[model samples]
Target: MVSEMSKKREFKDDEELEHGKVVKRFNGLPQFNLQRFCYRHNPDVQSSVGSTTCYKQDANRLKSVNDKISQLPKNEREEVHHVVSTFRKSNDKLRKLMLEGILTACCFPQLSYVASEVQNMIRIDFISILPQEISLRILCYLDCQSLCSAAKVCRRWKTMADDDRVWHRMCEQHIDRKCPNCGWGLPRLHMKRARNPTPTRCTELITPWKAIYRDRFKVECNWRKGQCVIQEFKGHMDGVLTLQFSSRLLFTGSYDSTVAIWDLCSGRLIRRLSGHGDGVKTLYFDEQKVITGSLDKAIRVWNYITGECISTYRGHTDSVLSVDSYKKIIVSGSADKTVKVWHVESRTCYSLRGHTEWVNCVKLHPLSFLCFSCSDDTTIRMWDIRTNACRRVFRGHVGQVQKVIPLTIIDIENLVVDDKQTSDPPTDDPHDPLTEDLPYPTHILSCSLDNTIKLWDVKTGNCVRTQFGHVEGVWDIAADNFRIVSGSHDGTVKLWDLQSGKCIHTFQGKSLQEPHDQQAETAPHKVSPIACVGIGDSEFFTGDEMGYVKRYRFDTT
Candidate 1:
């Protein structure tokens, strides 16, 4: 029992020694040493205990110094006290300089071992003196992470960083210059007039641009990391051929002879429009109506709200392969080797006969003045909607041109010349007739069954770039200003940089097979071909030949 007691006593001693060592190590740190020195040296320090003891010592020292001055001659004491008091109340810049000088002096041989507590009292007002405009311009160069850090400095900095204009400019420079929530670049005047009959005063509301940027940034990070919520839509019994998306609705056309409207948020079937005599091949929609073209060689316009057919356009002599509409104008490509433009309200049709084989895809420009079409004859043709004339023919694809889409043009200040070269110096006069007559220089993106995607200059009719990565035919393609997304029979979805024309990412789908897996090798390799792709602000949708539609969110860690 004595031995056990002695062991316990020794253990307690060792434990106390270990704790003392820890305390000694902590006290040796520069911050703690500075506090200890201040407490020991300051004349007015009353106690050397607690973390804040040095602060109280500073106050006491000031009082002690003033008491010494009080003992001097009356006129001398007043002058000295006045000087000390004024020095104490000076601006922070002078105080920081004095503190730094003290720190430097303390680094000398005799005082080197001592540390001062005055460093913590110094502050720098780097941006407060600058004009707000210049300050904002400097802040604009900071990326998202640095800007977020700058917001935490102080109340003034927070207010300046959170200015809506600053955030709006950031969104324009980084994110697309569109409402991240509504996906609209600018609100349409006609939409307001059509909704309200009394002609109410339309006022533009300032959006929460910072919040929008945060949401978009989070979604893009999600995409890069492959973090997404998977929801499978299984209404179509056959392959889905085409799809279109708005903020709230998803419209899908299928070979099952039906067009289904779905609640995009819930992924639930809202209604089915089934009037086509054959498989529905292509579809387009706006806030008011939906137009679908089918293998029955007819284009039908239906009221989306009521699911009632409003008008049937019967001009194509063969299967309508693709269709696009903007406002009252509609363009359709048919297997009869012709492209037709129709005025939806007046029912007037104009034929553009150029391709010798089936016209597989057609796209109308957002401006409604130009149309682009691709055909199985390995050619893409641009049409002028006003004159109903073929303006240019682009020939590069060696196989069937499956899809064509216009590249979103954000900066059109410099135009591309006829030789596919950019003009070095932009024309000075904005109203130059020669520049105006140059027919808005744009680019077209086309994918073909030749396992390649090509970028063409519309004004030059030259293939400016060709991107090749797919092991099989490239079937469908979609693009924004920054990236091009393509779906292929290779059972993979790829993301390409639009500017550099380099494939950056390859996304594997369910149909992708492992090369070395015996079980996968025994099964059919080409069971599912990606047929259509649709892109939203945060996510993208791809439909395969198995009738599976997938929504993948963006993630980057």
Candidate 2:
């Protein structure tokens, strides 16, 4: 249908390109405004001769041309003048031809002279010439460090680089998620969603976008550098089992069979809710209420502020080890080796049985109507809550699996996977195959009594990565977009870079901020296992068997 000449198009030296004609036609040429060169913006700099702040060198340039023309012999000068007049009168192509001929006739020295003169005459400042919107778009391509450096370049650059428009995009790119381009992550949504209502809280909601970025960036740096001042909350009498904190409150469940609420900032106990007949094994909370599972074979919801037992649900035949809720739906794991899905509105319960041993943990991902459970059977199962059926099984741990969490890893740097042949094939499913409209987590994080933490591929049921550092069993792990905080029975709390699957820092103590006073009632507990860990933007909290909760805060310093 097409001729060879038509398909194999030819281009002329003087012809302009399509789509990007303007940029290609004059790219690398000195920038100009009207007829004068933009000296400050133009990279083709020259010695100024009575030039103003505008940086024009037109006076010296015209003088140099005139002096050269006048130095030639009279007849030669007249001939050159005639040729120049004709060249000025001819078309662009003809002028180019004349210049080509002149350059071809020049010897090495003359050509070197020409090259030296033209070298600095072709430079351009492309960004300076672009419009504001286009220039901001270009700046958006730069990473945080590069943008900061660009802001230091000049007043104009600072103005544009510090603009809220640019930083807002930066916030969206990094905050609560990792930037796929830079692989740099900021704070997670948990940090932003937790609003401290105390008057001591800063006006972060009204803060400038750049200020927000700077603060979160500092927090991330502190986390990576292991720079933090830890504060201790010590009031629980028995071994602390589960703990979680928000912006202003810290809730801890303990072996004392009581759930204690404390002011997160001051580390002072607010109240204690006692309803469970035995040791509290797990606790989770949102805005309105707190939920806890206990070894008494009961799950209860409480109004933490009023210390009231709002309701109690009993279904598991054995001790309830873990519990999580989203609205009216609650999921719990028990020593009975089964998981129960409780529908509060319908007042009905469904039991999911698969594990051969005790189920240590259960986490509900309500968005996808999914649940994850780990057991003493050394395996984890993902269940479709809607159908009350097991969707997938993850088996790699040699010891009992203690905890499991579903995660949507935006940028997994080095996926930790088991090399051993698994019963299920390694597969990637970005979308849920069972439900076309819903999405599911790509990976899961689990810790075991085997003394390791593993990253699992959800679809393939393969252990993609394993993090090994704890000398004892890993009890719990909490993660955000950037980092994972794990507590171990080795009496240590370790922070891991979630992307790299590497341990960044480890706290090796009874989990104390500093040495206790000489007059204290008791010495710090040694080898007291950290039973639970919680993380935020600028801080992480670890609760140990010593009945102590240590808040490692990076923002303080």
Candidate 3:
């Protein structure tokens, strides 16, 4: 057998070649024994040799270390080579201490600080040692994901990995598990539903989005008078494109990956219903069902009471933009350049195809069983439900209409009752008031990518009022007979007086201009998408691209 000293020297030479350097000793210090230093230690060898075995084992250990050094990456190989070469030049006492430190780290495999301290002790003379159990306890406090990665490196770590309580402790640190009996202490076993009660994916840093909330946004004075106060809801993963409201609830459809429901009174999230593989573009709801049209090319009907999805209707090959429900018919608009009608009860499908571009919005004419759909094709078509044919194509908006606001003839008659009741309102009865007739101005109000909101006389195919003030494209519009509320990419909620063709008030929810990708010729900053809006007569909710919803009150009086 080769002498241990010669073997160590030969292995070291091979390591130097692998690392692109040669070892040079000037101060007669010893080098590290790599195998014992990083992998494991043998205390029995030190006992068997008694005294001289320290030197004999050190020689054999240094050979094994030189072999391990050859396996490291070229940069790391160079670093280890430089460290060993430079340390060998140091004095004998320092050399012996370095070898002993590396040996001590190998012997006490349970201690992480021993290795860390040895690395530190290599540079300094008198390093202090903390108790091994205390250091192990500290290591247990690290995150589960990080601990698991470290455990894969060696056998000693593999033994420590057997402790099940370590994972539970990590879970306790990261997640808030609901427990009825235990309050902020070691939780008691209790029945409660909480989200993601386990440590899963590693915690990644979230990039900061532009600040949307600021002090300058004054709450509209009219909100104080109402019993219900509105709050901004933000948790969706993407941009919201549509909104709908029921008696006590609000529904939002988003380009973000899911559809969300919120309690209007308490502003608490009810649940996020996820089955849509893509962004939800439109939302509609009734007493029994809530429907969402998604870019996933499918429409889903969810049971409103049970919060369970009843059926998924799929036929469109491209993004579904809008869905509207009538008595038994569910009309859907899609970018595939077609409109589909599904019988709500029976689920029979009928398709209407005439638009050249993507259809953006669809609605049923209230008095008649007629259906109207607007498209990026720059035309709105009125379809005859009975014939399944296009009755008339209303050409008005210069760009794609984002929403078709249907004003039914029946709603106008109801408005007449509301006008009469409100006008002569001094009766002892709380329900009864004045009754008068007001002329129905327009049957439909349509907003478009053209930066205008047009009122259309659906029966006559005439444009009534083209209200303009939004500097950017209008994504969604809501209205009564007197006023129209629009949400624009310019980040403002604007109220327009339909009769006077004037903007009543602007709620600057997002008051700052953001930088554009490419500078505009005139305006440097590009406007963001307001995305969606929902409103009652007095209060309106506007959603932005960053999943923020701002509640505003319109100064209607």
TM-score of each: 0.68, 0.78, 0.51
Could you tell me how far off, in angstroms, the CA of residue 215 lies in candidate 3 after the best superposition? 29
Q: What lDDT tens digits, residue by residue, belong to model 2 across residues 347-410?
A: 9999999999999999988778889999999999999999999988888899999999999875
On a 0 to 1 TM-score scale, where does candidate 1 land against the true structure?
A: 0.68
User: How does residue 88 of candidate 1 score in lDDT?
Assistant: 69
lDDT of 3 by residue, 269-357 (tens): 88888888889998889888899999999999998667789989999989999999876789999999999989867758999999999
In terms of TM-score, which candidate is strongest?
2
Candidate 1 wrongly placed segments (more than 4 Å): 1-124, 131-134, 154-156, 177-208, 366-368, 411-441, 512-527, 555-557
Candidate 3, pairs of clashing residues = 27-89, 34-65, 238-256, 420-434, 420-435, 420-436, 421-434, 424-434
Give one digit per residue, the lDDT tens place, for model 1 in 30-77: 233334344333322222222134533356666787789889999999
Looking at model 3, which ten-residue stretch has the lowest summed lDDT?
207-216
State in Å the error of residue 108, model 3.
99
What lDDT is obtained when candidate 3 is compared to the true structure? 0.64
- Candidate 2 shows a clash count of 6
